[model samples]
Target: MVDKGGYRMASGEAIEKVYYDGQKATKALQALENIWVKRDLILREPKELNLSRPSNREAVMMTIVGTAAPTECKSCTKKDGPFDGCFVVPGVARGSCNNCHWNSEGIKCSFRPPSANVDDTPAPRKPTTTALFKKKAAATAMTATAAQDATTTPAQAVTMTPAPAAANVTVGNFEVLPLILPPSMTNAQKRLLIQTFQNMIIVLENSLTDMV
Candidate 1:
């Protein structure tokens, strides 16, 4: 329980620790920023390092905590290397050993690269207007042909090819269409067919009676 304080920022937050003055705080803060920038890499400072004070009465305070590492690499060969932030102090949990052979964190850090932007989940696609309109147009053409067949008179309904039973229906200048059956046939076509047969029967009966 190291109790310490420094002058508060304008927001009333005391600096974490008042190391002699602001200079120490700056160094510790800068060191932390460096460690964060290089994770698993040679750290300027380790995550487990703790910079604390014993009292809060001073006008300036430092509450900086060093990043602590689990432990020093026993096989570190850079113990006598140039003194840099990456240099690790043996048996201490903060700072890192710069030697590649001794730095496990460095190997892992290579895989954890940083990025600025990320894509969100993709959205579903929609039907294009042109395709929808083409489908509708084809449907409309079929409907128009069916309707025209339903309205043809027996005189106008000339069967071009010799079919087995019923003649095909052909309009003014169009191709002959197959006849629709009674069950599946439309009401208009059915009525017209019935009327045509009835008229033909009447004419036949009257002519036969006259001849008799």
Candidate 2:
């Protein structure tokens, strides 16, 4: 029907406007057919890989290791089968896989390849400064202990290390120590000697200061 502004319109809303994409449907059918062909090829040929059939939830993203990298291909996607057997377009490569689309540079068929399964184990984390210090300290301690063990004999295997002397015990400024005299000396003799020693000490200190 024709609209007022010279634009074209379809029939009334009652006539269900069924839009069909013929090209899209054709492409989809072709893809399905290709998949069937690949599947048939797989079934017909001997099973090379012992992969457990994946469920819808755990659909594994298998990688093609034999090729340089199949992900780089335009036609194939990650959803494509990761079958061990080669599934190339027959016209392009039938006998020789070198002519296949999957070929990247100059790589060849599978001797042994791995899957692209998700690894459950966590990746090793980089060490922080604190962790690194702890490791270094532990290593040093271990090495020292090992060296000590190697050098030490049964008789000299001491666990507790002896403490070192801190300060020298000498006379400080103007400090008087106890008068430790012999028992044979009388108190009167001790008093006289002490008085004489005090005089000598004063004289020596004065002379030293003058020399300085």
Candidate 3:
């Protein structure tokens, strides 16, 4: 149909269209045939990995060893088999068997058994701005505690006398400022608040120094 003069009665446009369509179909068929040939060649090639049959004695022995943890450290048996003969995958839990080196001792499987708490254990928290902030806060608290402990002592408390109530009194030319405190605040709470503020100021000063 595509010969130079085979369709002499047909229009030139019709003949050209038919000829190109036929060429496309022929190329597609050739491509399909090539794919099948390559697939066959791959299938015919000899596979090096040969897993023991599930019912075989070696396979059963491997399964037992795979399921159990290694009795001795630094020694294990090595075996290459089908994916189903070893690790757990999708529908198959192929036991704990894995490829490992062998020694004079028995087949010490190298597979590490899954941890019992694997699912319950939480992933480690990644360090972030919040983590840094928490660390700084903790440092500040520690500093405040250390300063308060160092400055206060039982001996000073025993020897110290109570001072007169805070009042506005003249100290030379300038009048003394009246000290104001919350009515409900206790001595311990007041000391804690003062220590906290001091620690915060120190932290700010250290941060500013580092920036400079």
lDDT of all predictions: 0.36, 0.35, 0.36
Candidate 1 wrong stretches, greater than 4 Å: 1-64, 67-189, 200-212
TM-score of each: 0.19, 0.22, 0.23
lDDT of 2: 0.35
By TM-score, highest first, what's the ranking? 3, 2, 1
**Collision pairs in model 2:** none
Index of the highest-lDDT prediction? 1
Candidate 2 on 59-159: residue-level lDDT in tens?
A: 11111112234333322222223322333332222112321222221122231112311232346999999999999999999999898898778688867
Q: What ordering of candidates by lDDT runs from best to worst?
A: 1, 3, 2
| Positional deviation of residue 212's Cα in model 2 after best superposition, in angstroms | 48
| lDDT of residue 132 for candidate 1 | 90
Candidate 3 lDDT score relative to the true structure: 0.36
